[model samples]
Target chain A: MDIKDIMKPENMVYSKTPVLTSTTMHYCPGCSHGTVHKLIAEVIEEMGIQEKTIGISPVGCAVFAYNYVDIDWQQAAHGRAPALATATKRLHPEKYVFTYQGDGDLASIGTAEIMHACNRGENIVVIFINNGIYGMTGGQMAPTTLIGMKTATSPYGRDPKLHGMPLKITNLIAQLDGTCYVTRQAVHNAAAARKTKRAIRKAFENSALGKGTSFVEVVSTCNSGWKLSPVAANEWMVENMFPEYPMGDLKDR
Target chain B: MAEKILMKGNEAIAHAAIRCGCDGYFGYPITPQSEIMETLMEEQPWETTGMVVLQAESETSSINMLYGGASCGKKVMTSSSSPGLSLMCEGLSYLAGAELPCLVVNVVRGGPGLGTIQPGQGDYFQACKGGGHGDYRMIVLAPASAQEMYDFVDLSFELAFKYRNPAMILSDGVIGQMMEKVELRPMKPRWTNEEIIKSMPWATTGKTPDRKQNVITSLALDAAVHERLNHTLIAKYKQMEDEEVRFESVQCEDAEHVIVAYGCMARICESTIEMARKEGIKLGLLRPITLFPFPKKEINRLVPHLKSMMSVELSTGQMLEDVQLAVNGRIPVNFFGRLGGIVPSPEEVLEAFKNSINK
Candidate 1:
């Protein structure tokens, strides 16, 4: 059957789920955020949490995650999405709550909030999107920016001598007793995209079980910040960002 | 049923919160107000009453936790002193913007920065006015004694849920630390989760397609939409001023001088009023109970009869500005305050009142 035939309203097997709508995406060509968002929406739809989920949107380019994700949403103060998610989950223990944050927001200004939320073992999920550079702010050097990486803020190669070493938040959170599940995944390709969705699903399931804090960090590509074509950006993330940040689960239980 | 038990101010707040059927308490330990968390921790209300008690990493996290809890239509609260409350301002604004009902108690101390742990009304402006950004107002209740502390917890929670707005108990170091005779009431949950959800169907628990997906956001990208939300907020504030204005008046019938104060400072002002009365000064006390509504009408009423009004506070003349606005230049308004842990005694307040009246 043709693509249109399968996707047609009357012919579709799954009804239009509350977790996603038919609104046209605002993402650029080859942008991975759209794919990542869709994966999350699919998981919510399959798990039947669309009616009982609250998602926090951060201050980066994906600040409007609520627009695409059909669940209830609240926009958090810059760098404070983790704290917001922590509060939201603690108040409604039965509901599935998660925060969608970028590297700049999660690792820089909101570092304290994320660290403590994990330490407190708040039953919530944190979906961290680390693109190595600040996207919306014009390619600025971010906390996870690799050594020798060049950007608007760092005109020359990033020098570990000057700027601090890259932050591996998942590894750091794994040390905290409160964190029950901490994993670093990526969405550079179709295979990695599936894995990212599985990780997100696990994170949400942990919250439902009241297992404690669950964190999933996605090493994403920012074509605008990296100054690469969408295809090249995905390749760059796999070749450069993944090696330094690594992709694996740091904590299971 | 009648019940009475002598308790300290901090303990009274904890007991009153339990009686009010608050579902959660998120707070960090700070001086004077630490007893509030301490009492709750010892009482272990979580096991008995299903109350959720969490000692957050800091005041910032505590307030955000309150935000999370309140979003679910739960009766939630967080308590701290001046410095901690300052850290909570950001979350406070978000909560107000979201229009969630929650209780925040500030046991104030002297400060521009980390001033002192002593009792002071330095947070008068921060509490009475919107402490955070945006055009919003909290339901501010100022308690002068331990008894009022116990009573206002229930009252604050009632007002919070009634309006679906954040309410504050603006207490001070003296009131928080002082021991006093207080009556503890029996425990009762005012509204169950189902009741609260039924009342606020718009709350962000989840999205049911039957209802339009509810978004609990303060952000309105469109200028007209943003402005409309602001207008609605202002109208609500005006209504709150009309409905929630509360204060206590003493010897103001045919009085020549009036002393305006609130929280612990109001208690001191009461003693000053007594001493001034003994010295034949004919000074009256106007103690503001709801500091946000500020009893402005009462002040306006006194402006015609009184020669002058003097404001006594533990801050550097913060509430005096409101007093001036209320007087509307009809009568002179003077201010006397002690900052940075310095608390003016009753005699000192009396002296200030006498001097202001003489002037």
Candidate 2:
């Protein structure tokens, strides 16, 4: 085929969104961040608010998310992204603001900031990525880690008395008065990817309408952190992760 | 017309913030400084100046709000007392590391840990040194009067943006609570989005097709990169020390004795000079306005012209060490201060000065 033919609009399928840059992402293979980042980029591109979207990227494997998203970003310290989002959304109500946080960041260290931000009814979106382990810190047990999960910090498996139960943060947030929409999802396959994209789009749309806090929690898999093959990780996530964190809309308003 | 208001120092801070075109003010109520936010709540600047004022759940949330606003290239600030300021240290460190411009007013109270609600300059070491972790310095402004509190709000923001760094107004309980006449400046319109793009080109206002997306971050994983950032911060501090030293030298010319003080203590020492001079002691007062730049050079210049120096403070001689460093052993720098919220009178300061001179 000629070069011109390859560039033809009619031949195009699954081209990358302009909202994401050509820069290579730092996320590991089979890490959920890449899928989540793509969904956000596609949603922003689709909404035509690429110029008005501000992202607060938190500390974790996805801390360098700004490099790939190509949107204005404020890199927040560990769990402080929600606090940053609250201010950004309030100060510029005309703009769309969101925070991309990990399980360790959101459910653990930054619990207070996230809880208060959601409770304040700040018009913003929160995209929480949850795996069972802290990926950046070498597979440590996260607050969302499964009760019997074995990991670096929980060598003998998580004890209910010592580590506490895995936090159902989305359910917790759904109970708050300020959150307009809250849902749990995953991106294990092309079908799931499309569903997650729709969910993220809904979140962005809600923020644009000043609909308080809209959250889309992605129960993602970390193949490296979980010490499993990418295929096995997906299978394990379906069999094991789904029962604990079932993929469905928990709340919507 | 810009009307002069008889307002408390904290209230003047609120008035001046509204007039200074602050885009947002996030704070939590603390003793001696709750009036700062309370006044903003009463005035409701949203109706007039379009300023966003929020009473945060805690100082932690307030400082992070400041971080968010600062990242967006907006003028934002927060006010708190010593204990509250302690709670904000982590956020302050993050703000400094990111090189974000914002204002933090510390209406200092006595504290080892919530020691008293009354005024104290005990946080001098915390303010002058890096209050947070890492190698960084905030431009610490010591406002001794209600007028200074009013004036320094604009000045702190100016310095904050000029250097792309945090600036602080380190006032004490006396300065925060005292009522006095203040000349409120004319209102400045908040920066337009286009103006912000022009001024803070690196701020994360929004991403445009023509420009690379702005990322306001302080993280650097590489050792070399982190070291270079530290060097840049050190250079900025050096520049600040050179250009931003502010102090009031009262009667230092040919005086035999000098009294070094700042904030409310400086105001008290102003009267102490008069009392000391009457007793045939040629005493002068060196009041440091910008405590971080520290007026070191100016104080050094007066060393040869002074016989002895006495440092007066509300805390147990917290600022005396800086005075000694400025003197650099050229003269005897005696320390005299009241601990745990004791406000010293001019006579007490004079007595301390006389005792030092006699010794």
Candidate 3:
């Protein structure tokens, strides 16, 4: 139980990836972003591609993702990370390029950018974090907000006629021929987090293989935005979110 | 041996950019400037110079793509018309704030909103002033001839990377569409990854174990820090004004009236000067090559010799305000312009100059 005993490599079964910066993240307690960022860092470290990976960070809670990840980063304008990633990959075809974007950033205003990038079959990876609500702007209804889900923007529960149905952007992108791999995973639990990490690793591997765009959607939870406890949020995601966005590979090639 | 070829202004820009060793081109076609990407595509310079050419979905995506490539310390560029450029204002602002170096060639066409596809100099205000929202400035190079279009492509990138600020080749429909003889420069090779890292230490060229990760961003949340960032940009502008002002003077040494112009209209006013000389009207011409710097000192120097000054343009006098500000009310600086894609003839321009002098 001593510090030296715990510090030994053989004694330690788990440790943070060096690819993750020591700088603290601003994600709320139990936020899925921290988990995903860690997963990506671990995978990048495992692949020994940390020196050649570049990230395009989106505008949202994760806008300052550059601070948390120890890799070259380009902070793209809101909803424009995919477009930015396209240029990065095209310019340096040898490097691994990926975009980390939120639902509001990808599914709504940036719909055109993502669609065209995917349709054009840009050799890049797109990591989409879809939590049912906008976290950064304070509990607003996001494009992936569930029906009958209440938030600041939809205080009286989301009405289908009023707010329209939540967008299944990953499913939509999966239909595009440009996307070689499309998968929906989660980070709410340990098993789900492991699966999401594998998906992210595969996406990066696919990009290196020049296999066109690879998309990995993480159906996450926003406990603070949902006004629920962290434990409750995981339970909520299991009972509610999983049915709408089932955790599995929707398409693969 | 390098060859001299006949080419359109837009094509000249494309060829010159390739010869200048541009690493990438992301553009969406717009009228009067579509030839830039078309020429690049036809050349397929990727096979030779390793230049990457991509036809983006829209102007918005094209500019953002430049933002990404420029962030990576690559020589990237994009070209578009007025309406398309309007769609890129936000990306331009981001580029400015992040201090990313890149070239933007605006083959200007008429516009307030999709005004026309014909030539216009109405974007003078947008290019000279901070086109987007923020306290920032970009090097605005106005090229008159198809040859200048070829020359300024390399020069614009040089100035852009020198100051880590965006530079624009502010051509017009007339220049973009008109053909002329161009002396092509010898081809240069694209920058290798090592060369990029050596030149742009701040560029996000991926992180190695020895080097820290680089980030290209403009977001500063703290009020004090953001204000200091604005001050840094302001100082850069002052430095550029002091060192980068460029212009051409024709017959300013012994003349009574001076005609101020730039881009395609400058070529028009040159003819007007000859016609006015025959009419016994001693008119000189001051053509600004750099619009943002405004050739203020040159205009002020010519202020003492001139009886009056007038700005001639293809728009409703967008550059006139700069000429007036340069003169600072020491004498009258009038304006003559043709709106809605009208190119003024030499006779009518001379008449307008005479009318302004008489008034």
lDDT winner among the candidates?
3
Per-residue lDDT of model 2, residues A1-253, tens digit only:
7898788889888799999889988888888899899999999999999999999999999999999998999999889898898889888889999999999999999999899899988899999999989999999999999988889999999899998998998899999999998999999999999999999999999988887899989999999988999999999999989999989898889
For model 3, the chain A TM-score is 0.97
Grade the docking of candidate 3: high
Q: Cα-based RMSD of the predictions, in order?
A: 2.4, 1.4, 1.4
lDDT of 1 by residue, B1-359 (tens): 57677778988899888878988899999987999999999999877778878888788878877777777778889999999999999888988887878999999988878888888788888987888998899999988899999999989988988887899999988888888888777678646667866888977768776776667667777899989988887887888899999999989996898888888777878888888788888889899899887898888888888889988888789999999998888888998988777878899988777777677
Query: Against the correct fold, how does model 2 do in TM-score?
Result: 0.98
> What TM-score should be assigned to candidate 3?
0.98
Better of 1 and 2 by TM-score: 2
| CA lDDT, candidate 2, residue A230 | 90
Candidate order, DockQ descending: 3, 2, 1
Question: Which 10-residue window in model 2 chain B sums to the lowest lDDT?
Answer: B1-10
Which regions of candidate 1 deviate over 4 angstroms?
A: A1-18
The DockQ values of the predictions, listed in order, are: 0.68, 0.85, 0.89
TM-score of B-chain for each predicted structure, in order? 0.96, 0.98, 0.98
Judging by DockQ, tell me the better candidate of 1 and 3: 3
